[model samples]
Target: MKKLVYSILPVDGYYTFSQRFLELLKSAVSETFDLSAVIAPLESVFLRFETAYKRERKSEYTAKLAAADEARDRAYLALRHYLVACSYASVEGYKAAADTLLSILKRLGWSMQLASYQTESSRLGNLIAELGQEENAALLTTVQGTAWLERLMTAADAFEAIFQQKLTAEAADTNTSAYRLRKVLQEQIEMSLSWLEVQQKFNPSDKLTTLIGQVDELIAHTMTTARANATRKSAEEEALEEE
Candidate 1:
């Protein structure tokens, strides 16, 4: 158990550390029924921690937003590429419709490809509006581009919805705050560990001892990395000050 020293564990590393510890506990469930009982409450706490992490971590939030943006971007690109391909079709009416749409696209005076995230949705909205006009709509119907345009509009709206729902910085002040959840997780882990330690002292199982050792190693490695990072950051700050 080695006191499960976690004070030195960095904030960012907390999720991985607790997750490793939880997995270690789960692995030992077949070894002892008592450990499983202790893990039940602890697992609930960790689930909350994970949910909080999605809200708290900027990287996680950005990854979701980026995914939405990418889908919309792909839809836009597919629409353009489809129109370009249609321009060379053998069907005379389809070729004319495609050429007219492509010409309008060029006359619009921009590539409209890989736009900045900030302006992309509105640009997509403008393109959608232009093509959705009565005249362009008729052209799109001939080439069956109406469906692709709808997909682009759907993707654009999806991205805008996600972008507009940006997370506020006050997450830490909320009930679902990762910081608060982490504190609860820490307490739950310590309590669970203490219960297990008492069990081992009374019953003395070899399986429990091995699991404890593995948990100790995981914690020790995490603490070591945290300390090294702290030292490196301090050194960098000192160098900047000297400069």
Candidate 2:
């Protein structure tokens, strides 16, 4: 019975709202009542919207990125510890070999992983280049650490590739795509309801009443969610300002 408050619904909340609406009308929809054609096209858009949603959220894409970064960090730590642990090696030149590499690492002051994605990538690249220099290459060879260097390089490169993928996905207008799709669904739902309302006036039925009631429930839930999100965002902003 109630109309959708489209603007109040957040971008992330729009897909599920339309989805629930679709399930409600699936049995009763027709060319007369829902002439706005809300089902077939909506199903198609859902696929794209789902992908955009994943890209926009910190779920699948972000999880993979995080996993890659963790792997690289582990590789880096392994290499670092190997060099440091060799400082007291029983072999004569092992300590000297480690000292050569440790001097390079000591200049870093802090782990590059503590930096931002791009910053860490750049620093790690630079560190790898410095370690691969002709003179340092001999020291790496002496300590049997060329394999360690290769592992770090492999891990860092993999992380950078995933980071670049995340960047590309972000640059591909995923947010805008999601917003545009949500708006289309919202408009179609409202238009479909208008036609259904007119049909109900000419030919009253309990079916229409039940369908309207379900839609009203969805609207109520969506409104409550929007209001809660707004309140949370406001509180967060206030906290940041106080800080």
Candidate 3:
């Protein structure tokens, strides 16, 4: 598959946040992986897996560690993309994306914990529980400002579809589209979530139910786009290597 690259510009006041996030990702990666030796492998994986990525028959932690690195890279790339899209996002959409992204960072294991909130938007906790997700997995509260965030969360579900499945180093296969679309969703969700966070800080009046509805729409759009662009590029390359 083609490598995933997100461009988020035109978003005022978000550059610093995006840059800091990238720096944090870099630091976290450096602390975890041997860059010199692993950078190429990591890059290769990124180029191949962009979105339709899957874990090997490896241990969970090993898979999670590698996935974490890729997830971080994907998130960084997405922030840049959101900055660009920020200029056009509707008031509600912008807020939704911002909240979703912030919560996503925490959900992806990037942040250790969610801080308590004290504001009109603080009712977020209630909305999140409405989804009936797993414990501690509720990355953000379910408040009014979470509409964008909810949509972004749906995008994350698409991403998980890709990361958990495996691809072959062989000719095109039936699962290729499924894998790639998942990756695309992964990238899109990460960026959208961050955007939502920024939006919430500025406009806490957005409703949680509204954001959840928006998220469903966004997820559907993302899935369609990713599937249309499916090329089975990675599978072909893997097939060549096996020869």
Candidate 4:
């Protein structure tokens, strides 16, 4: 029986048994004991050591998982805030937004969704390049300014698409889609305001101002039309219930 138990003892268990055997010999110099007496205490010491090691290992693993989870949450929040900042195209605001995005990219570089971050970063770089070109022009002609605006708008659309994809992944519901649509519209309006401010400062002209006004009016009309449609649909549903 003793040989059978020894054959199955793990390496660590054997080490624990040897250490306990020395302690037992020192503490019981005059005592006479059978093999069972020594084996019992050795087994107890091995079990205690094994339980403690497992508990400590579990604690370390849990701490690592918690830290990872917190990092992910912080990265997500930073991304959202960066998008909000990017909606403002002032020179100072744009720089700040870019910095925020770059920081998030660096922190989450090893994330499973690294490709998504890279795509958004590339879009932001393109937008910044277009803005730089506009700034460097000696006199931004109407056609040239319009071209820059178009490029920025395209980049904004792509950025919004990426953001929507993230939102959908987090909350795959009808309300999530509606919320994303509203957010996109809000971002467009904010971006238009920022562009208008730039044109007002550097390329002041009635034509550009009128164009910006028309864009704002169009957005307002679209919102009014959407609300009316929703109201009509609700009434129709109520009438059907009455019947």
Q: What TM-score does each of the candidates earn?
A: 0.51, 0.49, 0.19, 0.24
lDDT, each prediction: 0.73, 0.71, 0.36, 0.41
- Residue-level error in angstroms, candidate 4, position 226: 0.9
Q: Is candidate 1 or candidate 2 better by TM-score?
A: 1
On lDDT, the candidate that comes out on top is 1
Worst 10 residues of 3 by lDDT: 112-121
Q: List the candidate 1 regions with Cα displacement exceeding 4 Å.
A: 4-6, 31-34, 59-175
Note each model's CA RMSD in angstroms: 18.6, 15.5, 22.3, 32.7
- Of the two candidates 2 and 3, the one with more favorable TM-score, higher being better, is 2
Residue-level lDDT tens digits of model 3 in 7-56? 21111112222333333334434343322332333333344443333332
The model with the greater TM-score, 3 or 4, is 4
How many angstroms is residue 100 displaced in model 1 relative to the true structure, after the best TM-score fit?
Answer: 81
Using TM-score as the yardstick, the better of models 1 and 4 is 1
lDDT of 4 by residue, 56-112 (tens): 334433354334433433333334333445545565445554544444435544222
lDDT per residue as tens, model 1, 121-165: 556777788999999999999998899999988998888777656
Once fitted onto the true fold, the runs of candidate 4 whose alpha carbons sit more than 4 angstroms away are 1-189, 201-203
Between candidates 1 and 3, the one scoring higher on TM-score is 1
- The digit string of per-residue lDDT tens for model 2 on 67-117 reads 787677667667777887787788778899899798888786336554444
Sorted on TM-score, best first, the list reads 1, 2, 4, 3
The candidate that wins on TM-score is: 1
